[model samples]
Target: MPGDVGPLAVDIDGTLTDQNRALDARTLDVLRAWPAPVVVATGKAMPYPVALCEFLGIDSAVIAENGGVVVIEQADFLSVHGNPDAAAAVLADYREAGHDSGWGTVDLINRWRETERAVSRDQPLEPLEAIAADHGLVVVDTGFAYHVKSPDVSKGQGLETIATQMTFALGDTVAIGDSRNDVSMFEAVGTSIAVGNAPESVRAAADYVTEATYADGFLEAIEWVGTTD
Candidate 1:
């Protein structure tokens, strides 16, 4: 099963995109041409991945907000599995401490975030983690941001559900990512790839580590799974 491309669960921030978070035009072309199923999994807001799928011209299958929300395309399957209220508590305390989310007042990062809150990577993590723990929420450092979410929900769980619904075995899938937030996803798939820019811990967790960084690494991963290099 590992010999085939099979299904793909890919990350956005530092895997499909460059360090500046721009989606790689080169990777976009490759992704659309993949013969197997593709799942856009990200720590981003729900609308972001959904919109990406729309632009990619693929069906809407996504695991957004670090698995806080799962949408199975045209099947009308929408499952939200996090405590936004708890996440809000952490943010509220963060504000009380005279700290902003650091994305400016508009806070587009968390504005459309329904199931959780995303704190800018520049913000101090200790206080936020304390607040989240007080509210029974967990904080995940995705390298791009700190996500406050429920412990029960994860990208791994989301992939498992989507795999079942799509009628594919987990052993037939591949996952590519570049952050600790992707660790769960790495564990869930049969073949896991860590981009060159990924943290050492993330790379250690993956089944293979790419020589190239960012979207290039994504393309390298696809090639390893029997897709065109």
Candidate 2:
């Protein structure tokens, strides 16, 4: 089972895009040609990645909101993970702490930016810590969203669910990504590939590194798997 391959979990953003936001066409074509199923595991909100997957012509599951949410179909939301009550409690705690910390839309981003400047001498985590402390939340430093996730909800768990449903052994999985949030998926799968564009930490943890980006990176990964034992 470990030798047999299964579904691949690929991340978006830095891995798929260059410094500017553009999907590599060649990479996209390679992914479309993959013999095994492809599942997109991302930290972006559902709608964004769902749209990306749709554009990519993928018909697989999308793990979004950094595993706080999962969408099996473009229209259906699968609450496979994340604790709503805990998330709410954290939100309330942030507000009560006078930080006005909560996740919403562009409004929240601006508010956090202001708060970020006011607190911690321009350190973002100052207010971030205040919010986390109030809510009793585990803060994942993604350098973007603070990621106030529920204890059990994660990309790894979501991948496991899909693997089980597909009758794919966990030991046969290959997870790829570029962000720190992807660390969980790396740990959960038998093989993990980090893109050339991945962060230093991510690259260090991966079993292999792709010479390509997006679908190209995915294609390199497949080739690596084919050649390795």
Off by over 4 Å in 2: 1-5, 73-77, 84-123, 210-223
lDDT of 2 by residue, 104-191 (tens): 3444332311011111112346656656555555666553456666556678887776676556676877787877888889999989
lDDT of 1 by residue, 1-229 (tens): 2334678899999999999999899888877887788899999999999999899999988999998899998677888989998888889998998876888888899999889998887888999888889899999999889899999989999998888888888887889999888899999888899999999999999999999999999888877767432
RMSD of each: 2.1, 5.6
Instruction: Name the runs in model 1 displaced over 4 angstroms.
Output: 1-4, 227-229
The residue-level lDDT of candidate 2 at 18 comes to 64
What TM-score, to 2 decimals, does candidate 1 have?
0.95
lDDT, residue 87, model 1 = 88
Task: Give the whole-model CA lDDT for all candidates, comma-separated.
Answer: 0.88, 0.65
lDDT computed for candidate 1: 0.88
- Candidate 2: what lDDT? 0.65
Give me candidate 2's TM-score against the actual structure. Answer: 0.75
